[model samples]
Target: MVTAARLGPEERARAWQDLGARELDVLVVGGGVTGAGVALDAATRGLRVAMVEQRDLASGTSSRSSKLFHGGLRYLEQMNFVLVREALKERELMLTRLAPHLVKPVKFLYPLKHRIWERPYVTAGLTLYDRMGGARSVPGHRQLTRTMARRIVPALKKDALTGALLYYDAQADDARHTMMVARTAASYGAAVLTSAKVEELLRAGERVVGARVTDVETGESHEVSARVVINCTGVWTDDVQEMAGGRGRFRVRASKGVHIVVPRDRINAEAGMILRTEKSVLFVIPWGTHWIIGTTDTDWDLDKAHPAASREDIDYILDHVNEVLSTPLTHDDIEGVYAGLRPLLAGESEASSQLSREHAVARPQPGLISIAGGKYTTYRVMAADAVDAAKEDLGPGVVDSVTENVPLVGAEGYQALANQVERLAREHGVPAWRVQHLLDRYGSLLTEVLHVAEGDSSLLQPVPGAEEYLRAELVYAVSHEGALHLDDLLARRTRISIESPDRGIVAARDTAELVAPVLGWDADRISDEVAAYEARVAAERESQSEGDDLTANAERLAAPDIRARAVGRALD
Candidate 1:
């Protein structure tokens, strides 16, 4: 059996010591999905690998997403056939081989506006969509009349569509999925550490060697050596390149996208809905107990880390979706609002929408590889190519990439375990629905979460403010998922920060306590962390209630980042 991996203080020390003792074959500079995938790909290929992130895993764009894994239907309009097929193939890989624990199939309805000439045109496209790389891991697409479409989506106005086409695509909790990818890499002998910032590149006469890494938690800096360094920082790709003192092949620009989550009752949709908008595609995705409606695409010049969504943006979505709805959803119906930036390849065109989603990997120098421009679905292929680029640096007889056949940690017996969920739930004394939820989220590794609840029934109770899930999840986030702060737990680990009306405020104290034992934080520390999370929630709330962008941004900026505070204190 493969040894279970954990990144403790002792292991962290060993990781650094190995850097000086021997040069690492591959060093990844991001903790997002792409970086995690790179680490796993390199490690599986029998090469020494290490990954460092400046913040918590997936703290940036990776965490905030529309959370769908689809063959880019809009790409068909542009005739970007190759990109769509490539992404579909990778999506199939994720649903089947790579991260079955994290990714699953979701069905969406495409409503048609035209009465004539639309069905055949849309049907042909969907038929091609079903055949083109998507059929490998998902069910076939179905054609439905307007009545049938309305039956599944009652909130949609009857006259809004002439007919519909339903198709399946993959969806995931993006943040958890990214962390699992990182953890899976660690399980396969890759050294993964979060909150380790790369201050500068360690270079020897113009060739990249390694990095100077700082432990944000301890304020300790260490010199580490590597043979090949791959920059996997998404929106911050340019920053990493500058640190390595190399000119990148391409520049990255930030495009802000926003999503709003409301209770499922508000939408009354049996399946998700996808519609064409004047600017971009609008989706009402079906999340568990909630509906996720999103996404406005506009260039962002403000904060890249936490892109604030203006009240105007909210009204934009509300107005558009309300136009197609029988009963409109007002501000009161919104439970959560989040905005994330897409790391798009920059272009001279005025529209960010015209920019390409295709990722590019280039080795500007002999020992440095920088990968940018790819979408989430193609991360594994990107990682594989990245490792392949370091073949010379890893020395003679470097093994070929074997990640295509390697299953992610929770994937081995997932289907079988899913079939036995009812029996497992009966044995565990929990409801079948709860068991299904666990199996879906954890796959075959649901036992890891259940172990905590078995000893103490109290841990099984739903959290106070959220009440959507278990308290054991909070404990697991710290013990296994690398949750560093209260915000990490509430925002990314469980998404209670965005799912609830109060944004996990009432549950903050309990979540802090749950992580205290695992993190070894003192009482004062826990209180401070909880307070900080509450302030963040408050800031976001205030931001949404404002009338315009300027006031909203000011309100959102009022919240303090825990790492920024530590940085400020260190400077003082």
Candidate 2:
């Protein structure tokens, strides 16, 4: 198993220095799901690999997804059978074999608008969706009348539909899943680093060779040599290409998708729900303690890091979902809101909404291979294909990717541990539900976290406000997972940031204190970290209030990454 101790600031820097000073087979740009997957895919193939990201793993579109391991149902309407089949194959792989601990089946209720025709029409699409791509992972779809559907979703409006169709898919903690993919890559000897930004590309006679990477945290830069560099930067794919001093055969268009989170009780439902919008589709995905409802798809032309979701976007979601809810959720009921950009392969589209989800890979230059425009479900396949194309540049000695059967760090014997959840809880002196939650999040690796909590029973106490789980998770975030900042733990590591109405304000101080000992932070460090986190939350709240994206983006930038400013002061 890959220990959580690897890929710290020191270790990651050394890896980059060695690569810059020496040579490697492949260098992956972007630390989202695809880049992480490519790193693993290449490393397992007996090839030297390194992946670098400007921010944390899954920090971009990967973390902000709808969190489903689903076949693209909308793609069927587009007659994109191949894409749907391809994604469903990956979905089955994740649930049954690849990352069973991380991915599991989830059912959704599709409300039928028309009295008769829509039921069979939607049923046929879902039926075909269940059949394709070695789909042994999830159960088949079920048809339901309006009355029966209301029982499952009691809060759904009476007049909204004639009937509904219940169908299965899978959900995951996208940030955690993406991190595990990177950790699995590390276990296979891939040099994985975060907060490491590529300042420019290294070249050898017009061929892209490696990169000059800057350690954004430490204000240090190093050169890394490689035979082939793959661009997996998603929306930032074009940025990476520009850094390499040139163009590609294709361009990526940014499409912004926004999601809103509300407490589960806000809309009482036994299962998730799917609804149709005038221009696109919406989903209320079942997340623990809360439900995830979103997504507005439209052209995005501003800052990529923080894609602002305007008041209109929020209203658009609430308006559509309220159309079907008996007790509609208002703006005050929302717990959190997030926005992510889709890296669409730009082409002949009258509007960005009409763009395709299909990905494209190309060796635009002799030594650089770029892949862009695929869904989160098919990231692995995209990674494998990215590596396959890179083989042409690297030549012989590239072995076949062995990542398909490889389980992530937490996946080994997850089913057995799940079965023993009650016994484990008894042994650990915790509730069975608590054990189940840990096991779901960490699989067999839950023991590692529990062991720490056992050392100090204080760690057993839950966070101050968002008491859904234990304090040990915060410690585990720093000790086991690579959570450097307070935001990383609360926001991505455990999701206390989004789950609580205070946006983790009540929990941030406690979480920071828990991780401080492990990180060797003294009084000043803890204060700085805590203050930065509060500032971040404040900025986010301000951003959400703005009337539109432009004002929202401006508000968010108010809390710039002060780490850079800190480094500058130290240097001066």
Candidate 3:
């Protein structure tokens, strides 16, 4: 059996030692979906590759997306057919062949406001949407009368829509998927290290060669060499290019997108809704037990590590979504708000929403390759292109990328495990829904996660405040999923930070104590982690109440990063 790789503390220490042992074929700098994809692609193509990140995996924009895998429907309306077709093909691959256990189909209703030519116009666009890239894994679009639409969506006002067009798209937990990609790369013999910061680029005459990396936890530095260094750092592209001693071929701009989470019962709908906004579009995406309504697209120049969502941003989404809902939601209904920056390739467009989502790859120097500007759904294509561009530096004998045929770690026997959910739950003495939840999160690796609690069966019980997650999952995150801090376990590994009503404050101390022994945290360290996380949650709450971006950014800066605090490193 091809077993999945475990990225525990011991493996991380070995990766650091191996990083300085010899020259590598590829050194990828970033831990987002694109960077993880690059490592997996290079490793599967038989290249000696290593990926390093300053923080935990998916700690940046990769985790803060709208969580959809659709071929941007708005792009189709913009007449960018090529991008839509390519994205649709990737979406199909993820749903059917690549990560079926992670990605699943979801239905959305495009509510029409006009009684005239709107229906036929939308019908024509959706017909083309259905046929693009042979999207047959999910059902096609269906036209519905107003009554039929109301049958599924009773939350709509009586006169909100003249009719509706329901279509299918796919969604996944972006953070988990990105982490799995990194883990799968490690399984294929790629050295994956987190909390490692790149301080400088190594130069051999006029060409870039490698980098000087810092271990954020222990304040240790290492000089690592590689034949080619690929910069997959989105939104921070120019900073890395400057480190390379010259400006690259392209520039990246940060576009801020904000999303809010409310209880699922707040909007009584059987299916999600898509409404056209004046600037762009609003998606009422259905999360597990919550409805995610977002997002406002505007230019951001303040903070990149932590983007702040202001009162204005929240109000924009609430007002737009309320225009069609029977019950207008207020601030009291909101449970969570998050902001992310999209690294758009700088262009002449005055509005950030108008920028293209197509990715570009360039070899700025003889040994440096940079990839920027793309949607989350098409990361594999972007990674393949970046590695293909590196062939010039690698000389010959480098084979083509074969990641399209490689399934992520947990995807391999998922269907068979899913079929035995009832039996597994009965044997384990847990509820069937708990088994299904584990299956959705871990797929065929459900047994591996459960195995973390071998001696103590109580680890299978639900967490105290956040009942959706199991205590065993927290231990598994620390032991297998590379969760190094309290923030990583709550925010990325399980998503308790944004899913809970109190933003995971109630579960903070208990969770920290639970993972303290695994992380080798003394009592003082446990107190520091808990205090840092609480301060972070408080900062986010205060930032959301501010009226403008500048004030909100100031408010969010109150919380210091736990990993950065050890070394007293300044925020980039």
Candidate 4:
């Protein structure tokens, strides 16, 4: 029986010490889906692994994705059968075997405008999609006429569609999923540390050996030795490769993708909708009590850390989505907005959307390996391939990846516990819906979270401002989920930053105070955390109102990072 891999403050200190004390078989950079997957893959394969992230896990593109786990329907249209099949297989694995708690099946309606030819054409595609990788986890597509389609989505314009095709795909909280992957890696004896930035690559002659990492929280630096370093830094791949004194074999181009959140009532839809745009597809995905509609594929050369969604980007999404909706949505209806950069493999096409979603792995140097360009659905395959590239350095004894068979930390017995939701609710003295909510987020590991509320039943009450989350959840994040900062808790752990209308402002001070004791935060530190979070929210709000990427990026960067500020003050 595998126990829950707790990633509390104690574990973080031990991880830092362990990374410096031993020579690791593999060192993974980046804490996105691919990076975390690589860490789990390497650790489960019986290889010693350590992963370091510059900030909280999934602080980059991983958290800001469209949050789908489907085999790209557009990929099938592009005749990229191999990529689609591989992705569908991974989707099946996630929904059925790997992360049943995190990944759940979601229904989507594809509106058909052309009455005569479109239905048959789409039917053929959906048939292939259902059969691809033996996708039996989700049901096959159902055709619906305009009358029926409008019933399912009353917000649809009468002329918007003649009919629709309903199909199934999987979705997950990308940030939570990535963090769980990191914790699962730690459970398997992998040293995973966040807020540890790689300042430089340690070199021995021509071969890359290790890295000098600086703790972002403290100014302390450590030289961690590893036999092979796998670079999964996503968009920052080129920058990291340059530090190794090599230009690298491939180039990565950043494609900006932005998503806006609106209340579910504004959409008036029973199911999510997927609309075809001239450039690409637009997904109005269901996200809790809100709808997430987005994604513009445009080249971006600005700041990678905080990719801002400008007014034009927001207008583009609203204009396109409004074309199909009966009741047009305005900027006032938007509750939250976020922007992320996709690391596409650069090609001669000049169009970021045309660039390949297929990933590539290369040993740029004897000891350095880099993997990039894959979509979120196929992160597991990317991880496996990345580790395969590092095989020569890992020696003959390292076995093949067993990650396909290995469920993540909270995955085990999830179904059984889910069946017992009513009973669990009775035991916890919370509403059945609340118990189900906890079960979905934490799976069988819900027991561990409830343990935090053992003596104090008030901990099970809803958070002050973010009522969707229990106070116990916030405590659990700081104590066992490696949330080192206020941003980590609100932004990644619970997503209150993006879900709330005020962007977690009302909850910042209360949340900081809740975890103050666990994190050893003094009064000054607690105040700083709340102030920094407020500044971040303000900057993000200001950026969204800006006209262009340049202005938005500048505004977004105005917020001082609390960790950076603390380090500077300490030195002063």
Candidate 2: segments with Cα more than 4 A from true spot: 1-5, 8-21, 133-135, 569-572
Q: Rate the local accuracy (lDDT) of all candidates.
A: 0.84, 0.85, 0.92, 0.92
Please give, for residues 182-299, the per-residue lDDT of candidate 2 as tens digits. 9789878888888788989988878998998887766778888899999999999888888777888799999989899999889889999888888878999999989999898888
lDDT of 4 by residue, 395-430 (tens): 788789899998998899999998998898998899
Per residue, candidate 3 scores C-alpha lDDT tens digits across 1-572 of: 45899999989999998899899999999999999999999999999999999998999999999999989889988899999999999999998888998998999999998999999999999999999953599889999999999888999997999999999999999999999999999999899999999999999998889999999988888999999999999999899999999999999999999999999999999899999998999999999899999888999999889999999999999999999999999999998898999999998498999998999999999899999999999999999999999999999998999989999988999999989999999988889999999988888998998988889988998888899999999999998999999999999998888889999998888899998888898898899899999999999999999999999999998887888796753332
Stretches > 4 Å off in candidate 4: none
lDDT of 1 by residue, 251-359 (tens): 9988888899999899878899888899988999988999889898888877666678888889988988898899999999999999988888897467887789888
How many angstroms is residue 386 displaced in model 1 relative to the true structure, after the best TM-score fit? 1.7
Question: For each candidate, how many residue pairs have backbone atoms clashing (under 3 Å)?
Answer: 3, 2, 0, 0
Clash-forming residue pairs, model 1:
358-373, 359-373, 359-374
Of 1 and 2, the candidate ahead on TM-score is 2
Q: Estimate each model's TM-score.
A: 0.95, 0.97, 0.99, 0.99
Query: Against the true structure, candidate 3 has what lDDT?
Result: 0.92
